[model samples]
Target: MSVFPSPPSSPPSDRRRYAIVGLGSRRELYQDGIEKVHHRWSALVAVCDSNPGRIELARRRSTQNGAPVPLGYLAADFARMLRECRPEVVIVTTSDASHHGYLVQAMEAGCDVITEKPMTTGAAPCRQILDTCRRTGRRCRVAFNYRYSPPRSQVKDLLMSGEIGDVLSVDFHWLLNTHHGADYFRRWHSHKRNSGGLLVHKSTHHFDLVNWWLGAVPVSVAATGKREFYTPAMARRMGLSGPHERCLTCPEKNRCGFHLDLAASPDLKSLYLDHEAHDGYWRDRCVFRADIDIEDTLNALVTYNTGATLSYSLNAFNAWEGYTVAFNGTKGRIEHSVVESNYVNGREAVQGGVAPGGVKIRVVPLRSAGFDVEPWSAEGDHGGGDRLMLEDIFLPEPAPDKYLRAADERAGACSVLVGIAANRSLESGARVQVADLVGDLPVPAYAPAGARGESVPMPERAR
Candidate 1:
């Protein structure tokens, strides 16, 4: 008889600790995971933000939710926080400009990193992040939570099983509806410098999904876009002479529903009003202004390493926040979508958009004579992917076999590499390749203190 080793007597408490940077809208990710999924193995040990009041607000919110109120810290700068907190992981939800600075520092400080989508703003920073990860041997995960949705995962499974045959080409169209789309124009993200344009900031998830589904990498991209609808010039032409910004304080604030009443939402209030004592940035602004550089609408053609082609379009001024995509394979086709709810336009806007229904999937087997449409069960937020991703991120079981959704540096790089290339293409009016955009950049040996760039708010109106 084979002798079996005795099981370890003690239970596992080897949970990894995390420190969150940038206490903004995304910080709820930490709180939700703590309450629902990762409660066992991980805890948010620290929270950092340039604004002390935001930090305090987060502590208060976490406490009310029964989580260990994390130790709050001011920016103290990212480098100092990494050294002081000594966490195993860092979650970066900072401003777009500050993403690279914090990511590089955390990796160099010997911590894994989980950053919000659109990993870094541009080619230079993207390369810097890739290089640092290459050097530091730390892992990096971009929160492209959509990948975990059961329907999308099922689509991937079908592709792998050759049920959808070899994917030939992909056609994707995403809409943001008025409530969700207009919100982009109202805040700091209105400017390109702050949010890297919606193409990079918002579509990173869409582009990354294409990369994942095709099992390929983007080779080249070319795009064109315009901000025709949401501009002050157009507003004036339409017979309205409102201020360049949203008329929140205008006597007609009630008439124009896009008004961003800063006091309406608690998060908005605590973050913008109370926190303004620390930093002077404003969260609410006009959607139509002269200074916006990002496009409200964009279209791009992408060629992948596997020679698959993808056509993409993004519009921010729609009536909802979701996407619908179809994959055409040599044998069959598969499509998926999630209709998002109305954005928190203001505190009093009680309207909510229930998910349209379910992910509608169809498959045409190579030998099939007809197409079969299947409706997947409806899921929670983010097409039901958010909760699953949190489980994999915050909790893991020890075993000879384990299910993992962890992404490393290369995966992280692949997701945003196309967006970076697209941004370059946007400016040069030329087709740009991912390799060329990041070529010859130095990856830092260790996380540095800050970035060497200027901060500009997203344009209030797309151009």
Candidate 2:
């Protein structure tokens, strides 16, 4: 790794000081925004992680990107970073369960917080973070970058305009192919205590999008989840005998389809492999580990406060990625489907179906004919929502967003509560209510249907 100049004395008056807590691959998404696109508006004041190699690597990458090298802080010195770096905003990109600690600390220290999705793992942490945000009166922005994706944004606009009339219900199903989904089993996410399972960790994105799209909060949820696939028996059925803790030393490395050669790629090596001394975290654990607690298959039935019901399902070991969602409304039904590329999370290129032809959004009117809606597409990962979301986050003077795209603690809490409820339902085998998890949670602000009042109403033309 390349060593570079020291940290700058102080941020300019035009910029906001930022300290990122996690130095994993997800850190790059935010670092790129600060270095290349938002230089004028944001500065990387400090970077913190448990691993020393990642800290140095972040500094090297920042040097390469023409950004000022930030001060490095170990995970133990997170409070010291707040005291010395005095960052105006603390970005929590840590593991799922650890987010609440950083969020609470930052808010209590009179700093705003921006966190990766799922917010925190369980209901207790979620309550604590919510209380901290309210008590400290600081903002906590959850990065649900999917909300800004062009095709999804179009769906939001269509719903806001009541194009499909009042959304009565939804049927949403998301699939994660073997490559991408299996990667979770290889990392810290395999344990329910670490990630609160995929329903909370991954589905937070999907649940949040649904809540925002419908302009409502989830009220009740009944769910079921199990580990049907990715079991030891399945691995043995593939003619792979014996048990291995991780793939790095597995005898079936050549034969196993799920082997991840972390040492082969320099980036992966430097990011994870070379830094095992400090954390002892293995990034290439066996996908079929017997101790893995997270469910590979999950189904949920949710009712929103706005009288909208959703039947949702998630399957990890699927043939392809992406999703199919349909909104049933009074006037008509709008359906959206996508096909996405599958790969290990931080490996090759960006994730999701950003390509032009892979996504389709259609409208079927109740009375007239149906028509295909050409989606508003953008380039980059997660259907190009990351860049747009970054613009909103990093820009000093962002344009007035009527979509209410910038999410606060309420949005953060409401998003995770659905999954939290679902997780409870999975355990109890009964319907779980969101309010029962977090009592009297405030509603997220959404624009009224009159947002498109200036536009003329369209009637179907004679075919």
User: Which prediction has the highest TM-score against the true structure?
Assistant: 2
Q: What's the TM for model 2? A: 0.94
- List the lowest-lDDT window of 10 residues for candidate 2: 447-456
Error of 1 at 313 (Å): 0.6
Model 2 whole-model lDDT (C-alpha atoms): 0.87
- Candidate 2 residue 361 C-alpha distance from true site, Å: 0.8
lDDT of each model, Cα atoms only?
A: 0.70, 0.87
Superposed Cα deviation of residue 222, candidate 1 (Å): 1.0
Query: What is the per-residue lDDT of model 2 for residues 262-377, given as tens digits with 9 covering 90 to 100?
Result: 99977688899989987898899999989999999999999977788999999999998889999998778999998887667677786775544789999998778789999888
Model 2 pairs in collision: none
Q: What would the per-residue lDDT of candidate 1 be over residues 1-463, giving only the tens digit for each residue?
A: 1111122332134657788888887777676676446656776767888877777777777666666666667776557666655788999988776788889988988999998877887777887898888899998877877677777777666766766555668999988887778777777678878888888788888887777776766778998888976787766665557545444455556656556777766757866766766676666666777777778889999987666799999998876677888888765677666676666533322223336563566775545455645644434556567666776677665332121344555555666777777777878899988779766433221112232122333423423
